[model samples]
Target chain A: MKKALRTIIFVTTDADAVAAFNAYFNPNEVQISHFTSGMGAIQYVKQIGEADLLILEEHIKPLGAVQTIHYLKDNMNYSGGILFFSDSDKNEIYTDNEAFEVLKKGFEKSDLDRVLGLLSNKKKPVELNSKPYSLSYLINLSEGDDIFIKESIKIFNESVGKRILEIEELFEKEHYKEVSNLAHNIKPSFEMLENNLGSKICDELAHSQVDSSKLEQIKLLRDEYMNVQECLKQDFPELFKRV
Target chain B: MQRILIIEDNPMVVRSLEFKLKKDGYDIVVAEEGRQAMKLLHEEIFDLILTDLMLPFVTGTQIIEHIKKNYPKIPVIVLSTSTQEDIITDAFKMGVDDFITKPFSPSELSLRVKRTLSKL
Candidate 1:
């Protein structure tokens, strides 16, 4: 059997879209981290590291997909793949040759499938221990009203619940390697739920908080996450339907 | 508080305007792309529009056209990095109230915001 390749992926879209995307990419080794919005994606990637691929929508309302792409590519130093989607364009906005080229060329949509194929072609199966992390989902989910975004929290809280426990066990083992890898992997999970404790845990793993100070920070973060888990379990048991 | 809509792409420029305008107590809404800027107008009414010439998704000119056709009550000012005569004339023809270029002092943005808000 071929050894699996370890890679990081970041995505932003609706919860349903995210769930669908996971079936396709099957990211990381042990767990999968997912995100919801463009800002949340940018923050997660900037704080952690580069993602192997970025699956985005071409027509996210309120914040145009192209403009957010500008912010991500320009400010974040993202070298990941860019995948975009748009609803059947009612206006036929890109019918003009000039418009088509700008959309196709500037956004680098041309290189998409090839990137995906190459990623999939990596042949090695995913690491059983790899986790998917993405936070952009929260930002994307938080449109229209607070209810929509809150729904994202409820959904992601469930998705990441068990994995949080598994990682906590790994962390207690002083398995710094696993902790660092898992931290980098699940950074998106903490972000989508706005689980500040999860963020602090991932932050230390993602960044340079090595000594005693970082350890204490992680412990504090773990406590906070325990509270967040309780809150999520008690509130909104049904969770919002995916869009 | 008067409502102002700013459609600009560059963050540095956006932050600069945001800083000065907030100090003046204006309720500001921002859009980095023309398409997004237009969507905002559909829901909220702004007193004045301070737009840039170039934007992603939809151009600044498109914004002017949409606003002209729909929200004629709102005055518009074009504060962009472009000073091309055709751009100016076109914007003016589209009913943009004023056109100013960037590298301008903070006072200039304050003045233009004041002028446009005052005229409205």
Candidate 2:
């Protein structure tokens, strides 16, 4: 009998990602567990550190990605393949680990099929879908130079509301530890666009200490981030190129 | 030939960088941690430093700050996948010469290294 290759997947939305994975990933080689909650995922990885593959997501805590992955690995004494999947796949796509990101975004269904087929048959990388240099979006970015700025703005307009809603929910649930993490996660895109106002708001909300103060900071910051996004959409149509 | 130091844990990235720099006729040295990197600075002088931000025991920023405080002439460039603003700003505050996001082209990296070396 073939040995089972255990996989611990910290997932949030199934929409199509789970289905895609299920369609692929050999049953004999892959035994996978999905976690809807971030804390629960961490607990499982801690209690059972036998996973051979780890799929992480940024939905649980906004910017808790690098920190969470490191912490989980440290606590569990787990060292294996790691993949990060984020629903917020607007413009940012990891290049070095681009193949994994491709899988996470449900982009390369055929490659995933090949991976499953190889794993099921106990094949090596020789027969699998091998990429020449991890598939990166920088290649895409060069082509999308004209559209990149506009597309970025559109993504900002669409995601800002959802980001604020998520943060508010986290606050309501008293996930105080995650406030800064979430802000940090969102701050990058804002900073990349030189959105100083939005960046400042995220910075303040991330570091606030008191209860009411934190809430107030979040509320004020959320508005600022949102307003900057909207104003960019309206005020600077020439520079931002709103879609 | 200019003295160059690489502080990165990932062997693949290091090897890739080494190939590009060597082809350009620059002398290079590499280290994986902050403390070991600091030790190398004591023995040989480097014109430029290319470092990754996230590292075990010793961080890229710590190394950059050490170089700035003691050597002052060597310029440090931070290479990271991390997009955190504070980390980027902190590196500059500690006197980092340039910051580049990860998955950069080896040619582009080589060009930046040349530019930094020329500046010194």
Best by lDDT: 2
Instruction: State candidate 1's TM-score.
Output: 0.34
DockQ score of the complex predicted as candidate 2: 0.01
* Runs with alpha carbons beyond 4 Å of true place in candidate 2: A1-243
Docking class of 2: incorrect
lDDT of 1 by residue, B78-110 (tens): 865332567888899888999766533433466
On the 0 to 100 scale, the lDDT of residue A179 in model 2 is: 65
Q: lDDT of all the models against the reference?
A: 0.57, 0.59
For every model in order, the TM-score on chain A comes to: 0.38, 0.37
